[model samples]
Every structure is written in C-alpha cells, then in structure tokens.
Target: MHYSFSKDFFWGAATSATQSEGRVEGDRKGENIWDYASKEYNHRFFDGVTTEQTSRFYEDYQEDIQKMADLSFNSFRTSISWSRLIPDGVGEVNPEAVVFYNQMLDELNAKGIQPFINLYHFDMPMKLQEIGGFENREVIQAYKKYAETCFELFGDKVAYWFTFNEPMIPAEAGYLHDRHYPYVVDFKRAAQVLHHIVLCHCEAIKSFREGGYSGKIGIIMDVIPVYPRSQHPADLYAAEMADLFYTKSLNDVILKGFYPEEIGEILRKYDQLPVVTTADKELLSATKIDLLGINYYRPRRVKARESVPNPEGVFSPEWFYDNYEMPGRRMNTSRGIEIYPKGLYDIAKKIQNEYGNIDWFVSENGIGIQDEEQYLQDDMVQDDYRIEFLEEHLSWLHQAMEEGSNCLGYHMWTFVDCWSWINAFKNRYGFYRMNLETGEKTVKKSGLWFKDVIENQGFDKNN
Candidate 1:
C-alpha cells in the first residue's frame, strides 16, 4: 500500500442498539420512546416498519461479531440500550439483559475486537419521557444512575465509553423540529433540554471517575463544518453564527467545560437561556473528557438572511442565517445529503487548532444507498459508489492526521443494513448487505474492498 495508517489506528464500523438489536420488547427490554412513537405514528415510518424489525443482533451477535472479524475490524462501536439494561429507566437491573450484554461483550473480546460502548443513542426510556425527559433535572439524576449502572456492569471489558451519540439531535429534532419522539416545538424547552443533557453527561463522567474505571469516556457529536456561501462579510458572519449555534454550543460545553459566550448571548437575547445552577457549572468545569468522537456526513453551507425574523416569533437558529444550496456541489441523491469529503478535513483542522488537539476519531461516516439491490452481482452487492465515498473521506482524514491532528480511528456508520428511525430500511448503509425478508447477510463489494484496506492498513488509489 502506498498510504498507511498508524499500527494502533482503529478500523471498524458502528451500530446502535435501537437500530440493530431486534428483540426490542423481549429479554425484559422495556419500551423506549422509539417503540412508543413508532406504534402511535406508524405512518411516519417507511413501509410502516417499526423498531422491532431490526437486524436481530440480540440473538445473532455471535454470527455478527464473526462477520465483523471477517471484515477485519479491530474495534467495534455500539450502544447499550438504557431501557433494556434498566427496565423503566431507573431502579432494577434486568437479569436477562445483563446476561445478553455480557455475552455480547465477551464474544467481541474473544474475537480480539475492542468494544466502544455508548450510553444513549436517541432511545430514551418511555418512563423517563413521561416526565419531560431531559427537560427536568430529576431525569438527569435518573440518567446518572443509569450511566453509573452501565459502568459498574461492563466497564471492565469496554475501554471506550460515550455518554451520548449525536447529543444535539434530541434537542433539535424532538424539541425544535418535532421530528422525533415527545415532539414539542418550543425553543425554551429545547435550550433547557440541551443544558440538562450536558449536565447529565458531566454527572456520568463524575460517576465513572468516582468508580475508578480506567477507560476513556467521551461524547459523540455530529460535527458539520459550516461554510460561507461566498466571500462576502455578511456570509462569513452568517457561517460563524451558524457554527456557534449548531456545532460549538455542545462541543464547547464538553471540551472547554463551559458554554460558548456567543451562544449564551444569543440565548439570553431570546430569553431562552437555560437554568444553569452554580453546582452544575462547577461539576462541568471539573469533568474533562479523554477522547472525542466526531460524526461527519456533510457540511452546512449558509448565507446571511435577507430579512430579520419577527420579534414576536419563537427563537430559532435559522434567524441569523439561511441554508444555501451551492450549485455544482456533489449530492448523494440516495440520502438527499450533499457529499462533501473536505468537510472532514476542515473539522479535523478546527479541532487541532481550537479544541486542544484532543485524541479523537471519526466515529461515524458512511453513504446510504436507497434500493441498493439493483447493484448486486454474483451474490455481492457491487457498491462501488460506497467504496469511492469511503476512499474520498479517508483520503481527507489521512491528510488531516498527517498535519498533526490527533485522530485515532475511523468507523463507518454501520456494520449491517439496519433500521433507521423514520427511514426504516429505506436507505441501506452497511458493509454487509442484509436480506430483511430472510434474515440473511452477504458481504458487499465495499466490504471486500474494506477488508483489503484493513489488511494493507490503507488503500492505493493508483492500484
């Protein structure tokens, strides 16, 4: 290989419990917000498919981990379902759930694969959601208990622990846009939820440290680098504001242990500032993370808004900037998201220059192709486009690493084709293609190419 990565670089794929583990209601798994919402609003999901119709990882984890080994993965990222681990989200730990998770962890360890476990991934226990979820401080305490339980149970085998996956998504989708469960279109509630989530994360970190666990704990953020639509000063300012509101707001609190002053000013102006107690502030300041996980899919292109928002309207992030669709930009038609590989490089450079050059990794990055069956050839899905997408993104990541960025790994979005929130299985994002109807899995062409990339420690474009 012409290009190679460090010997310790992690090469693996990621999946969430809600998206991949099928036995949603079984094995003492209590109902989560996804289960309740999918049933009540079945029309919202594609093909009326529910979370119950996932990849059956609960029962097939052995075969799945073997497949992961087949793909030459040294580290795998997955989440522990809070509701599954502690039914009703609080008091008692389910014995069956414990058995299953222990077995899964043991199996991965036996195969020489490191497990990176995340605590939350948008699957809030319904019991917690019944009382305003993260909006109430009581729920934050409950989440701390849950996180502590997870550490006490599995911290020995899992070295990397993440408090939340895409933490901003819950605040934005559930509160601002009404795209997720407990949908409420209130700006103040969204701000409060974001605040409580950060506090809860700190509490978890505090608990982990208090327990004397040796593992590294962090948060996984979806980092979308914001770009100005043009060289105009207005557009540049718009991009700056967009980045502060969307990306820096959460990251600063986690990395710097304080909310960005610009974000606080905007929130105060709108009278949407969250209630941050002095104790909470001190707690945040004391707990710092050992690693950062960044999920990059696309860049946010923005321009200055032509008109100011009405003062009487509810505060929103879009008030200062407008999303701009740049002409001639490459688009992923399958997922309706722009394909911008350079955004990864931009994010790495920002972390290197601004965020203390912390140890980090590409926790999630991949392409999703709708109706990918047409590309099948000789039992393997010929996903050459997906391969190209990986190559382009990894090339940028390699360049960033060479430039002194402390990036440690790269993990694609998924291991197998699994159910997405509302999209269900509409868009396939997997190295191994799963026959949803038959529960069969076949490695795709991208999977084979990735095997070579792993074995060689890199890929050669000129090959």
Candidate 2:
C-alpha cells in the first residue's frame, strides 16, 4: 500500500547548533554551557566525549545543506546557539554569529529548503548558568532580548521559529535527574526551572508578536504519551499522573495557555509548586503559540506507586507513579527507549481531541544505533533497522492524518549522526552517518530510501 501526503507537506530532519556547529572557541562565539561543562566536568560525558568536537557544520554547512537538497528535504530544523549569538548571554550580539547564521539561512533558502529555527536547544550560555540558568527569573528578560535579536536579524530568511526544543528535558535531565548539566537532583529546583522556561517562552512569543516578524513562533515539546500497564483504576490513575507531569505540564501552557488544575494540585500536595505570581499568570494567560513541534520517541508505562516515599527522601516525578516495565515490550536497547510506533498515533489523536486540533508536526522522531559501525556494508551503513523504524512510525502517522489529524509534516530526529550530550556518538540516528574519525559523512541506505519518499510524497509499505 502506498501512503500519501499533501503536495505541500514538509519533508526534512532536525538538528541543533551545539551538536553540529563544532566551533566553540573561535570568531568571538561565546562559550555555551556545554562548552564550559565539557571542559570543567569532562568526566560526566560518555568516554569523556566532550561537546567541543562533533559534526563541524560551522565549516561544512554549505556542502551539508547541498546534501540535504540532494536528499530531497524540502524543510529543515536547527537551532541558534544562545552563547554563540550573544557571547555573554545578556549583552553584545556576536558579529561573527550574525554572519554565520545569515549565510546559513540564505543557503538553506537558496536550496529550496525551508528553515525552522529554534532559539534554544539546551545550549545555555555559561554566563547564564553561572548566574542561575533558567531558575533565575531575570534570565527570562535576557532571553527575550536574545530572541528579538534573532528575529531582527534572520526573520527575512526564515518563516518558522521555535522558542525551545523539548523544554521538559532540561527540567528533568538537569534538575530532577543527572542526565545533563547542573546535575542537581532536586525536584523543587526542577519545578522552578520548568516554570521559568515557560515564562521565557511566553516572553519570546511576546517579543516575536510585538516585533511583527513575518513568521510563526512555537515551542518543540517532547510529548511522551503515558500508558497504563493494565486497565485497572490504579494503573489508569498512575498513567494520568505521569501524563500530567511529563506531557500536559508544558503542552497545556503552550497550547491551551494555562496549566492544568491537576498539575497544581499534585505540586501543591508535595510542596513542589513553583512560584506563579499574578504577573507570571497574566503572561502565561496572554501568550499563545501559532503552532507546535511534537518530538515523540517513546511512551511511558506506569503503575500505581508500589511503595511510600519517606518524608526525608527527595521528591521526584517517580514519587507519583512507579515506572512499569511492560511485559515483552519492544525495546531499542541502544538508546534504552521503547520502539513504540503507536505512541505517535496516540499523540496525534491527543492533539486532535484534547487541544482543539492545533497545527503541529513530528519535529523529531528516529532510532539510534550504538553499534552502527558494525552495520557498514560496501562502505555505507545498511541501516535497515532505521528504515523499518521510519516506515512503521510513518505508517501510523499517515493513519492519524487520514483520521483528521492536524499534523503538518514529519522531520527525523536529525539529518546526520550528530553529537548527543552525555551519550556523545554512542547512538547514531541519521540518514547520513558521520565518521567521527575523519569528519566525513557517508549516506546510509535509508537516505536513498528517504529521498525516494520525498520525491514520491509518501512511501510504499510493500516495497
């Protein structure tokens, strides 16, 4: 069966500046949190693989973008580094960054690929982190200015602007858990950081609207659909709580312009609620996005809490519901995430039914292979697993669109096997596999298949 899409559908992949633009110290580009952290706390990353080195898109973007065109991508999403743009995070826009971003955006447009620019992708300025990162309310105004700078500079070349990519991630990985920088394990700090990020997002939206940039601005959320382990009331309730915390906490504010009552109730119950002053509430209520970006990679399975938390114990998301390891669940061990295609469809239906069917897209969705090197055949990574992953997920997505979903397009997690924070290059997820040893990228078998999909507007599952 051939799954089809609209003639104007967007076809591309997403990447970030910190991961691909590997020029951290030159051209007056300010040191970002990753640059500072990788050097200061190098032991934290996998095999000490710091972010200082990765896909050198800074030098090779023209060629890389031409490659994107060759692969038939009509649209592409990437981010501008906050520190690189404003060296100090608050003042003095970097002149070199202006040149680089302008040229890059012009190149993308020249190649007939629409550019989706995100302001932040967890690459905070070291200066900001030194003060307080997202926890400091003052940083909100600074980010607002930085966002406005991007608008004034690049608005003519780009039409899609996203405020943040996966805001919940930094809240979880940085504060509640130790996956990313700051590595603090405080739930209260996480709440503060998350609330502050929402404020920052709204502030940027205000700037975009007030600046009158001829473009759409939104936030990219990692919307992990939560599922109950079973049909029992306990499991269902647990799933609901997980959804409220992981999914709705940000989606509601971005889409519906308000936080859910259940989120406040649980946060208040645990004394974990962040400050939501009258002014903050007013800003949130006043802000609304033109669209949204959905990055769905996995689903969360949960059951009712099996044990009680000690009063002295640290509060966390897991406190509300215990993670349930669903029996015989399909797993992508390399990334330690479940390979659940149905989750995408569930998320599509969720946006349709719960959120007034807002326009959105699969901003990031792909599998990662830790040992991708072993799959090399005839000097190309024969990533049939990735091909299958894309097909299954795209099939379900097509089904959702057939059922009246407002999904606009699909973008894979990345165009090249770019660097990930702590994992470094452990798991590769891209149509073009970058050889870390030589900075050379070779197209995978999937790239050839994806090019055909783009030209044909869809895919034939039977092939």
Candidate 3:
C-alpha cells in the first residue's frame, strides 16, 4: 500500500465510556440500560456470562493513555456517561464523576492526545429509560440539560464535541428490532423515538451555542451505503429507500435541517410519521452543527421482493425494502457484513456534494472477528485481513480527498477490545487486545503497523 493523507490529518482511535469502562455500579453511578441489559441478556452473552472487568479503563487510564501515546495517535475519542455526570438525569453533578473525567481529559491532553468528547453513547439513565427513554419528548429536554452541563464543565479542555453517537441504532434496535433494552416491537414508538433523538441532538447543539462554548459540536451517525442488487428499477428504488431510512433520515435533518422527501413519504405511507410540533421544527431548523462524524461500517444490498402485508410484526425499515445478499460478495470475518471499502469514499462524496462543506472525520471504522487469536502467532496478531480492510478503505478515502472532501480525521471503532452489548466477547475489533481475565493489554502487529501509518501520514509501499 502507498498513500499520503494531508499533513494536518487527525489520526487516532475511539472507544466509548460504557463499552470500555466497567466500574458501572460504583461511586453512585446510576444504572444505565447497558448495565441492566447486560445482566438480563447474560445467558446470550459469550461463555454464558456478562462482562465484569470490561477493559478496566476506570482503574487503568494511565496505562491506556500510555499505550495510546505510544501508538503515535494524536486524538482519542470517548463518550461521557450522562447518568454518571447527573445521577438523576438532571441537576446535582457528582463530584467523583467530574474528578474522574477531568483527570482523564487532562491525562490525554498532557500526552498530546486531543480528546473528542461525545455527550451520549447509548447509555441512557435507568430513570430516563423508565420514562420511555428517547421515545418520550421530556427526555429531549433532559438531554439538552445534560449537554449544557458537559459544555459548561469540559468545554475548555474538550474542543471537539459530539451530541450523540449512532442515535439511530438505539431507536431501531431497542424499539423495532427488539434487540436492545426496553425491548419493544413497536414501529410507532420507533418513529417517535427517532424524532425525539433527532430533536435531542439539535437541542444539544443549540445548548452548546447558548452555553457560550466556542468549540466544534457535531453528531456521529452510522451510515452503511446501500447498493441495489441489480439495475432493475424496483431493486434500485428499494435500495434508495433503504439508504434514506437507514442512513439519511437523521443525517438529512442534521445536515439539511429537514427530513428527506422520500423518508417523509415512507413515514406517511405507514401512518407513523411523528407528530412534529411547531416548536420541534423551529428548534431543529435553527440548531445546526459545526461538524459531522461519519461512521461507515458496510454497505447494504437490496433487491425487490413481493410486498407482504404484516399487521403485527412491527413495521421495520426492511419492510419498506427487500434486503438481498449479493452473490459472492466479499464477507467480513463476522460473515454478516460485506467488505465494501468504496462505501467510505461514496460517503465522503455525498457529504461534499449534498451537505455543504463541513469539517468531518471517519469517527468509527473497523473489522470484527469471532476469534481474533486464531489469526495470531508469536506475540503478534498477524491480521493481514484486517490490514487489507483498512488499507482498502483508506485508498478510497484518499480518492475522496483528491476530489475535494474536507475530511479532517479517521478513527477506528475502538482502541482496545471491549464488551459489545449482546455480541459480548463474541467479536473482537481492537488493534490491541485486552485480557478480560486479568485486565492486561498487549499490542498486536496491526498496532505497530498503525503507528507507522500515523507517523508517516499513511502507508508506505516500500515497507
């Protein structure tokens, strides 16, 4: 591989507070949905158990930051648990939480690793979850308050801010797919949840502005490009619809200040369009972000199928389109997602052409495998497949830059192996493996390769 990113490129890695931290039930930290969901779904997790040590970032930030700096990374992205900051979801900051986060940020800064702080990362406070979580309009106000508190407290040290990380997933997974907490199969509730989440993002952006935080604020959305299975008109149409609902619905509102016309039609077709109040629209229209974080994982393959009416299965985005498996497509180690690296460039191109020029980054991109150790040997995980995964993606990203995309940075899905919700320890996507049994860390060969890429600004063909 041979490549050269811009001299000012922000190269780093990412992790979430809930996914990587395990001191969840201590220091007056309120229970988050993940905390309860992990226990409730423990039987489904790996080894018929749930995670207890979970990367141990809470007790080992010093070591973690040391490794991150050693990797030559310039930035580290993580989220702050809202419930940890305000145990009741509003008012009264927990001094312990404040001290912990302050220390973490200060440590990263001292190591020359800029912190990109995300306000929410799918860990809703149990109290808020009891009140219907994102489905309830009241939670939007609560989220705005939480955002304001974060800006007021950490704004100075943390200049890069994200309002929500993959807000769409929770809405769909928790409500429609019944895969996450508060598992309810309700399409109407999903639509309402989606609307409320989007409103919360916009309100948080406004709150940052009102709180006088003169820093960049944005939201990270997971966008998997959709490819029609064939050029057939129906397949093409269905693929377009899938793209609108899965990737563009939330993004359209954030970037364009309104929902896409096709999405509106789909919503109305199902009679599930959210009852948008005048105030909601006003706030959404007025609240614009300073940046956008594009998290591209894979592309969707869609084909036309006979529409079957389902009166009770809970309407889903897939109901609006038929999903297809592309014949002989390159599959990831997970065997569920396809490897389509060009999707990243397509995403960058879309942002450049449709959404006005804005600062952006690949906030989340990585490959996952069932057994990472199977690919390891001699004190190193020789993940050549993983290397290929990243190199192919970056090649397209380089093309996007040459064609005029203001992409500022690229961060992988994680810095270390951590617990994934139901997936548990089933899949690993870390450059450095974390030993859950002992909370020890070891760098893989890919980690060394990444350090070279960071130092040289890209891959070196001669190497």
Give the TM-score of each candidate. 0.98, 0.98, 0.96
* Residue 142 lDDT (model 2): 92
lDDT of each: 0.92, 0.91, 0.84
Q: Which parts of model 1 have CA positions greater than 4 angstroms off? A: 24-26
lDDT of 1: 0.92
Better of 1 and 3 by lDDT: 1
What is the alpha-carbon lDDT for the whole of candidate 2? 0.91
Give me the displacement of residue 369 in model 2, in angstroms. Answer: 0.2
Which of candidates 1 and 2 reaches a greater lDDT? 1
| TM-score-best of 2 and 3 | 2
**Displacement of the residue 382 alpha carbon in candidate 1, Å:** 0.2
lDDT of 3 by residue, 1-463 (tens): 5789877798888889888877845667777888777787766556754535478787789899999999998999999988888987877888889988999999999999989999888889988998888888888889988988888788889989998899898889888887888888888888888899998888888877877877788889888888898899988988877888887887888888888888778779878888888988887788888878888888888888677757676677777688788788888858488889999999998899888867799999998888888877886778887777888888899889988999999998779988887787778888898776777789887788889899998885432
lDDT of 1 by residue, 1-463 (tens): 3668987899999999999997744588998999899899999899999988999999899999999999899999999999899879999999999999999999999998999999999999999899889988899989999999999889888999999999999999999988998888888899899899998899999999989998899999999999999999999999999999889898888899888888888888878898988998898889899999999999899999999898887788989999999999999998888999999999999999999999999999999999999999898999999999999999888999999999999999889999999999999999999999899999999999998999889989753
Runs of candidate 2 exceeding 4 Å displacement: none
